[model samples]
Target chain A: DVKVTQSSRYLVKRTGEKVFLECVQDMDHENMFWYRQDPGLGLRLIYFSYDVKMKEKGDIPEGYSVSREKKERFSLILESASTNQTSMYLCASSGIRDGGYTFGSGTRLTVV
Target chain B: AQTVTQSQPEMSVQEAETVTLSCTYDTSENNYYLFWYKQPPSRQMILVIRQEAYKQQNATENRFSVNFQKAAKSFSLKISDSQLGDTAMYFCAFMKLISGYALNFGKGTSLLVTP
Candidate 1:
């Protein structure tokens, strides 16, 4: 079965700490995305990569950075975690031909 | 800018009943795609149904179907014979080539299935 796997299901980080959330897909999809989900905000895109070593900022990219070193792996980095950054983070991937995305089980992050 | 809107924040339907969740979007583009995604308690997001702007026939998957009105820019999801496992957060999203392959998601509607 195809899958998008997130490295962590839940994480607690201290304020000002640098955090990393990793995602890997086995479907050989060309596109990978990271989003943060809040109560009322729904899912806000943080970053997405169309190919290895290429990345683009989404609507909510502040305080966040992404790394795509390989075709199947994408990492979301919180440069300096803050309390306001606490939210559920999701990773998704889709093929160039597929119109919909397949998402991984999300990571719930709490920045204290 | 393209924006997707889910007017109902919360909804409840009895098991085995039918329910419809409304979604509307704002976009000037004539060609695009609309999708409904379900996120259960496990937080695993899954695509429920999708409709293409140019297609007149609504898309259906199992017990789920969509009401797509291209001229009105409305795409609603209908769940028939709803089951307990169907309870989840449903989000409506819009995608267009102009949006750079990124999906603009709505606020999501929290649905509960009761016996």
Candidate 2:
């Protein structure tokens, strides 16, 4: 099975903290995505990267950034964690020609 | 931008019965894809089924099938012989032929299976 591993299953941070959420996929997928899931908001794309050193902003990119220094790893950064940023963050990856996405277990972040 | 809507926030079905979850989407693109994903209590998102817009026939997998009404912009999931393992949050999603194939997901319907 292709595994998408997240660094953490749960996280807590104080306001003004710089947060890092890491995701790694062993499937050698070319496309990786970060999504924020909340009640009533299903899942909103935060950012995505199609290749190394390549990234694109999704619908809600404010207060968030990403890095894809390596093909297997994609990282989501919170410049300054805020209470409103508290949500379940999901990491997903797919092959260039594949239609289905393989998702990580997800990390629930709580910002105080 | 495309939008997926799942009006049923919650649904329940008895074991061995059938249940349907509704979903609708809005988009101008003629060719696209729709999918159903299930997230169980374990929090892992699993692909349940997928349907291509150009295909007239609905997609099915084992006891899971879809009612794809392209004209109505509706893609619903019908689960037959409901099992407790089926209890989970089901999301309807839409994707265009874009480079990333990023999905536009609905709010999701929480389906609970009863004994």
Candidate 3:
């Protein structure tokens, strides 16, 4: 089975704190993505990396950044956490195409 | 911009019966991919089905099938003999081939299978 492991399932942080959400995939996929899932807005892409050191901004990349220093691991970083950034964060990985994505269980972050 | 829309916010189906969830997308890419993802309460998004735009035949996986109407830009998932395990949030997504291969997902439909 393909596994995408998220480091945290739930997180709470005070405002202005820097946060990190980690995701590791054992599939050795070339693409890794970070998405913010809200109630009505669905899953909006934040950042995605097609290679170990390459990254691209998605639709809602305003308050978030990503790090992909290694191939199997991708991390989403919030420079300064805010209440509006509180939502369910999902990480996914795919091969080279868009056939389908294997997603992590998701990390629900609550910024106070 | 490409968009995927799942009109049904919530749906219910009795176990052993069938249920169909509707999804419509707006995209200009002639050759793209459409997918149905199931996100259970555990929050793990699983790929339920996938369809290629160029293929005339709809894709199916076991009891799950898709009705793909390319002209209408519609893709719907039909589950036969729906089971309690089928209850989850279903999302319709469209994949773009430009820049990076990323999925643009709909808000999602919350499915409930009653026994």
Candidate 4:
């Protein structure tokens, strides 16, 4: 089955630490996205890539960066993790032809 | 920018009953798409149903259906004969080509199914 796979399901990070969250899609989709999900805030887009090495900032792009080195892998990076960044992170991919997105199971990160 | 609203933060319904989840969005675009996504305790988000603004007919998937009113910008989901497995956090999202297909989601409604 076509899949968007996140590297971690749950993560605990210390404040001020640099964190990396990885996502890989086997579907060869052209668009990849990272979103931060929180209670009452829904899902806020952090970054999205439409092509390899091409990234665009979403509404809540602050404190986050993304890298797309290959067609199937997109990585989200936290330059300096902070307590406020604690939330569930989701990764998704989609093809241009079909706007439907395939989401990964999500990564719940707890920053302390 | 589009904004989605889910006023009902929590809802409960007994098994075999019918329940509706309301979603409203604000957008000036004439052509777009609205979607309902379900996220159970497992945290795997699944697309429950979707409706294209241009289509006057509502979209349905088995026991799930949508009431899409383009004039009011309302997209409500109705679940018939609710089951225990239907309990989950339901999110309403809006998408448009102008926004690069990035979904604008509302604060989800937490639904519980009881016996």
Regions more than 4 Å wrong, model 3: none
Best candidate according to DockQ: 2
Task: Please tell me which model should have the higher lDDT, number 1 or number 3.
Answer: 3
lDDT of 4 at B43: 97
| Tens digits of lDDT, candidate 3, B1-115 | 5888999999999999999999999987899999999999888898999999999999999999999999999999999999999999999999977646899999999999999
Q: Over the stretch A35-100, how does candidate 1's per-residue lDDT look in tens digits?
A: 999998899999999889999999999999999999999999999999999999999998884788
Model 4 agreement with the true structure over B1-115: per-residue lDDT tens digits? 6999999999999999999999999999998888999999999999999888889999999999999989998999999999999999999999887534788899999999999
Chain B alone: TM-score in each candidate?
0.96, 0.99, 0.98, 0.97
The DockQ value obtained for model 4 is: 0.67
For every prediction, compared with the true complex, DockQ reads: 0.62, 0.82, 0.73, 0.67
In TM-score terms, candidate 1 sits at: 0.97
Q: What CAPRI class is candidate 4?
A: medium
Model 2 residue A25 lDDT?
98
Q: Model 3: how far is B97 from its true place, Å?
A: 2.5
lDDT of 1: 0.93
Output the TM-score of candidate 4: 0.98
